[model samples]
Target: MTSVTPGVPERQAARPASMPVRCPSQVCDLDVLPDGVVVTDATGVVTAVNSRALAILGADRDAVLGADARVALPLQDLEGRSWWTCADPYGGLATRTRISETLLALPGDREVFLTATLGRERPRGPVVQVVVVLRAAAARRRAEQKTSALISTVAHELRSPLTSVKGFTSTLLRRWDRFSDDQKRLMLETIESDTDRITRLVAELLDVSRIDSGRLELRRQPVDLPRIVERHVEGLVASGHAADRFVLQVQEPLPEVWADPDRVEQVVANLMENALRHGAGVVTVAIAGSPGQDFLLVRVSDEGEGIPEESYPMVFTRFWHSTRRGGTGLGLYVVRGLVQAHGGTISVGRAPCGGAEFCFTLPAGAPEHVA
Candidate 1:
């Protein structure tokens, strides 16, 4: 590896026990820093190196101590000069400067792109200390790339629903007198469905933001599990899905759940919607509770091709999609967030019918009073 600082002296002074040594300047403890830290004396000899710095250099603490700082990190500026040489023009002033896009050539021909910040402590003192902080260049680039991709995906997903709503409403408005009552109803329903799709997409996006920021909100209350599942199935039927398509099997005298009713409905609805769109055969919603159990179990299963076992781990990841069409890929992610927010757990597996089964548990609430 290329060495940036000058050769180490034969007899080096004893290194200080603490960083910044007795200087009046405030100094951050290198040991507590998350990033790699390398501290050097005025003559450019490695005096102190943190554990993280040793890991980055692939060397032991003893190997780097008393060595030339330049050889350990081997940082070179864009102009092909040692970083220390480039900073030498500053004449030992106490200043903090960042060297962007610097190349660090390590042993074994491995190179890492880094941005190094160079700071001096007590520049005018008899003994000046230089501190260098290093960060990976690829990390910042990856974050920028992810942000760009999310924006593009959101815009693309929003366009289709917006176009459908606009077209259906415009046609209904202009050709109102020519349509029959049935035709008018169908058009209005189609528009409403498209509008709902838009709303769902927007809500999923917002939920993702909230989940990422650890700010997801849940209004918890005593919820009747059977009633919520039945209502969701009824709504699906009213939306033109066959009533027979859904099968709800609930154990008698099931306990109430302590959860958010609206969020519970959303979880069931998203799962059933997934089944209808991607699964085949009967979609069954089953609820049961054991006498000694503290939680109620709800399972939504379908009789279609089940997800591969290896893919189960990624099913709940944000923006993950099995197919190109349908969904903003946030339904299951948001569902998991909402469920966990209420102190519940959700999982996916193969149903008895050889298809996807989503099972979740909710904490049981107090017994209901029959008045």
Candidate 2:
């Protein structure tokens, strides 16, 4: 542990026996703070240091407490000037000034870019303490990067559907008299399909916002799992997916599930669509009652190349797509959110057919009474 400089007041000596110290807020407890905190006297001699500060500095609490703030922190401005000299701490300037473009060099050869704010605890007191708060610059940069990527992705996804709709509509309007009935019908269908695609993309974006704000809601009711699965398969076929490509298997006398019917359908549809787009061979949807359990287990499996074990944890994260052209990168994230809202657990694994398998369990409805 780094040792604090000598001549500083000990923890007991800092406070008078007559006066008790009280924390004004939970943040006053330095241990719970996410950012590093260091307190120094007006002359820049360290008086107190938080655990986070010690960890960030890679020094011991005792070593930092009495040390000069400049030696312990050694911050440098963007122009390579010492932050302590430039800031002029001992001058009559207020301690509340924000320090920007500062770099802190740790003892272990690691450096952290940071922004700091300095404030005084007692402005007119004889022994004033300057409080410094440190925030990591790298974290902010990462957040900015993610925001830029999301904007780019949204623009790209929206442009494709909009282009298709515009091109089809323009062609039909210009060549309406020359087109036969079949050609007009085909163009109209294409436009409608493109419109549906745009709607789905917008809906997924809204769901993501709702999930982030903790406002995702579910209306739970008794739902027939097998029926929902069968209906989704049929809908896929109607949307041009080959009917023979899907296989549905339901265990005999399976109990109805306690879930939101619409959300359950959404989950099944998303998983089926993912399988159709990414997997090879027949896609299988299976539902079975868990023996001696109150949940019904459902699995959507495909015979395409299986997902790597390392990638399983990230599959359900928002904006993460396995392929460059995958839809919106929000399908699995929304599916997981809906399943969890219904008191269910979902997981991904290798199927028996050597491909990706998504398994989820939903609460079973009340059991029927025997006559």
Candidate 3:
């Protein structure tokens, strides 16, 4: 799902087989860090530099450790202004603490962002040392670009539905007596559907923010997942799908799950919608519980052209839809988040009918269920 927000350690440098891998903290283990670190004295003289910092700054360790901080690490903002000259950690206000993370350019086109933690004896006191934490800015910049694209796309998507709703309502209001009952009903129904779309888009934005911020929470309750699926199937039929196109297979005596009802329905709705919209033929939903009733598994498949194996990984990522339209493209991402929040996993594969199949699971609930 686009709105749903969501790693490994760096490999150590190869060492001689006989050499020990121990990092002695007493001698300062800063060299083992993946992030660049540079520590300077109050006078802005470099006191210590890590191997990562040397690599990032492209400066020799011997030349940098005892050299002037400004001379050792020449950094400038986009406008070519010196970073140290602007920061002035020692000359700035006594109350000033750490320098916030900033993007700066080095010689050539290399870019790095760093933040300095100011060590102080007391508030508004003289600075002791500036501990600058540094990292390559390429990944962060890429993330910013993606965020901007998603925001632009979401805004564009929201506009279309809102414009339709406004147009329909305004027309109906201006010519109320000119329309027949059936026509008016149709217009109102269209508006209602558009309104639902707008609501879902807004909810997706909020869910994405929450998921990204690690604040997305589940209102746990005993959920009849199969019933939820059945209700969604009914909704699909009501929305104009043929009844026979959908087949619901529930392994009776299935266990209930502890999940949020809205989230549970959202997962089902997204999958069923994808099956109908992207895949061809009949849609089949199969539900069963794992051994020991620890978790419940739901598999949704279609009789259409299944997703290619290569695109399987991209299916659950934000805005991954290459051809599909009329969606924020965040459904599967949000579904993945919801499923994962319940300590479960979701996967994609070819179905028995040669169509795409999505399978997800949820943890079992307690006997004293809410609903």
Candidate 4:
């Protein structure tokens, strides 16, 4: 057999301490550790404990010491069962086998959690003592409840706009012949614009889920950078902005970029939409070619009221809007993600046109031949 270490004692020789340290008179004297600690004897009688334990149990040291420890700190199993079958599920004092356990409050009216372990001095002896640590469980539960409420509120708010767009589109499509050519075109335009708005909102919702799940995917393809820019701007114009309201400045003989075509379109569209919403008169879409750099630099500028210098960096963050306009505030968030997927960068700043400017970069290369 191996020899025992100097500090180690055999189970047969270990005995419980009958005496406990009397807590000081100072009510402010609490233990350094957040958890309240309690030391008990082998027979489960209370011995020594910190002031935190005293406050946790709402009892004086004289009233607790030498009493059955289980009367102050009880033990519970995983299923929350008590030592006796008739005990209240939460009322009985019980130490949990696991590190995290929720228990009922004493007279203090605050929920308490007890974490305990069996401490032994000898291998063969009964657990000579059980040390129980206490913490309040109410704070964590409150935080979780608040987060659940926020999610429910956001979901309910989003459903209204989506329902409006869906109902109008379905109604128009079902009775196409009942409308005149001009009416038909107007209804079609409304349906198309509303559908775009709905799509953007749904995409934003999915982007949030993708970010949480780590499943954002970008499809890289050979795309004509300038052509995509012009197309997106034109489509956005059809949505609201007139053709003459925005100007395009793309260098001739533009290079094809290695990018996700649809995502790239989303980036350009979001920037242009932001410009139209925040800017005053003219919005310029500029594409400059960087020959040796293997990237195409693009800038979307508007002549509206510029953003404050301090708010520049926050524009791309999720649900950030500096203005009072009715927007879901996810446009720039989606833009940044799409730009990053192409291994590109995007930034916002004051535009020379007295508005806000959004700039981004993408790879510049000739279209690759497909099989």
| lDDT scores of the candidates, listed in order | 0.74, 0.76, 0.81, 0.67
| Candidate 2, 181-208: lDDT as tens digits | 9989998998998999899988988887
Clashing pairs in 3: 1-330, 1-332, 1-333, 1-334, 2-330, 3-208, 280-304, 306-356
Q: 134-178 in candidate 3: lDDT tens per residue?
A: 899988889999899898988898888889899999999899999
TM-score of each: 0.78, 0.79, 0.81, 0.57
lDDT of 3: 0.81
Q: RMSD, model 3, all Cα superposed? A: 10.3
What's model 3's lDDT at 122?
68
Off by over 4 Å in 3: 1-35, 51-55, 58-63, 90-101, 117-128, 365-371
lDDT string for model 4 (1-371, tens) is 84432211222333556323345532234466677777665555566677778777778888777666656654443455443133322222343222345464544345677765665444443355556677766776876775575476457656776676777677777987787888867766776766676676777778766754668887777887678877876787776767898788978656667777888887887788777777778888898877665788999998888888898878887567867555766667777877876778999888886788888998676435421
Best prediction by TM-score? 3
Error of 4 at 362 (Å): 2.7
- Model 4, global lDDT: 0.67
lDDT of 1 by residue, 93-144 (tens): 4344544555654555444555544444444333345566665545766777
Top-down lDDT ranking: 3, 2, 1, 4
